[model samples]
Target: MYDFTTFVQSIGNFLHGQFSPGVATALEWTLVILIYLALYAILGLVLVYVERRVCAFFQLRLGPNRVGWAGTAQTVADALKLLLKEPVTVNKADKLLFNLAPFIITLAALTVISLVPFAKGLQAFDINIGLLFIVAVSSLGVVGILLAGWSSNNKYALIGAMRSGAQIVSYELSVGLSLLTMVLLTGTLQLSAIIETQANGWWIFKGHVPAVIAFFLYLTASIAEINRGPFDLPEAESELTAGFHTEYSGLKFAFFFLAEFVNMFTVAAIATTVFLGGWMPFHIGDWAGFNAVMDFLPPIFWFFLKVSAVIFLMMWFKWTFPRLRIDQLLKLEWKYLMPLNLMNLVFTAILVYLGWHG
Candidate 1:
């Protein structure tokens, strides 16, 4: 097996040997930042391409087939156009917050991804309260939306932002509770610990019905959290003319676009980590031969495979479901998901206490 941790340590040692300790540390930090920036840009372009191709197929039409072979360079070209376009300045907008909003959202997305365990020793930050940290940081995106809407001084933008605030606030409880149900089975908040506990089997298998229910609740709430279709009241183009970002243009608008894709990736990655088993290969009890065959593949491969499955599911919902009314969205969360989630949590807790859950 490839020792990823050792590889990272070797690079650090080489850097220290080439420079003073402080200089080496500074360089390491710079490299990490640059790597994450590159990752963010790459994910945005790749996800956009995947989304377009997937939706086109759903609609029985050809997607981006121009620019690069099979339309691979289409998103790249679009990104370049956004980079070169001049940002429109609103005469009466709050300059400080209007400009600052996108960075807040982009920062939240970047920061939360750091805590996810992509594979063993592949995580950037493995804090003890990783799960809690994710919940807190992910909630910050709504603040940016609110600021963007309010600062624009447009009623449509403000209404869109207000809807986003309510939607995120209501659905966030379901997301948190569903995750909490998993925490009961794992008995730890550390993301790495959660994956390690799943070595025997994933919670979705070991924890049984509650885990399955939690997984569904997580998906439903997460879809709403990221503002994907059916739950995308915040950016309803048909009604709000692009919603909270209506007043933004050029690079500013690009930031919001990038943030949405990044948020989608983050949501799916977290789901992969929590419910599906982060990078852990599947194994049936006492089946050494089968387990060994599964282990032949690398952990990173398993991690990405699970994440992609969850992403595809989200995309499927977006393309297939009709948009929900603001009232309907709230009612689904409060009246249905919340009550069911509470009962599921209690049931999971009993299972954990009785030693019925793995």
Candidate 2:
């Protein structure tokens, strides 16, 4: 029965079963938007909270304990502070672009949420070209960044924006390759199909060393893509004093900030789905007892565990590695990851062709 010809038809079947087709269809669309919006807000709050606690753990300091039990409410407070502030504007800045940029970036990130599969039957849309769509949509945020920096009419902001543009554009190559490496093995570009291909075991396990390498490669490039910590040259405080967003304040600034944290979740989710089997629980071939134990846990739990592991690793990099010089950052991408990824893809293709992937 789950052999859905299309995701839209699947939704229609479920909605029609519940109520009048007309009302159910309208309700489905309305609820989907609300859910996505709630998810967007919740992602920012949860990420900020997690990042603070994780940061404190590394620094040997108590984080936001005073705000709300163990600082749980700290992000909530921060959100309120931003929401209440007056948006400031510079006279010389291009008001139109400055105002439009944050929305563009935020929308780009939000659009990807609908394309991801959180669970087997849970997703907004399951398109055939999910991978290509995600990559394209994910890259559109750069335009907003460029506009934000340039429109601000501040040289520092402009420089920061340019740096961010260059960094994301370069690292995206590695990200694509890292993902394509796994796709080569799985033989599908569909996100849901890729996850299903790993029903027996995660790619990192079945595909072995090459898959492991691609995972790390993707992780590093993702860190740079999100502009976090060491790869955060675009917003280097000591250098650009907040960089491209220096002129941003209030809700506008919040949008940019929200997008960064949400983007972190986006990459982590993609990594989880590609490398760790999306919402599929782990299973070891021929290990009946162990497989049963794994199956006892919900698929969503397995998915979260994998994504959390990836997110924690990213946090570790942020807390440990010092910011790389611009030259070093670019070199790491071009001289290192790019070559490694290409070679890995070729090798992976050979392995697939020989039926040796498992």
TM-score of each: 0.97, 0.94
Best by lDDT: 1
Question: Between which residue pairs do clashes occur in model 2?
Answer: none
The deviation in Å at residue 175 for candidate 1 is 1.0
Backbone clashes counted, model 2: 0
Instruction: Score residue 333 of candidate 1 by CA lDDT.
Output: 96
- Any runs in candidate 2 off by more than 4 Å, and if so which? 1-24
User: Per-residue CA lDDT of candidate 2, range 283-328, in tens?
Assistant: 8789999988878887767778888888998999999999988999
Model 1: pairs clashing at backbone N, Cα or C within 3 Å: none
Query: For candidate 1, lDDT tens digit of each residue in 113-231?
Result: 88888788888889989899999999999999999999999999999999999999999999999999999999999999998898888888888999999999999998999899679
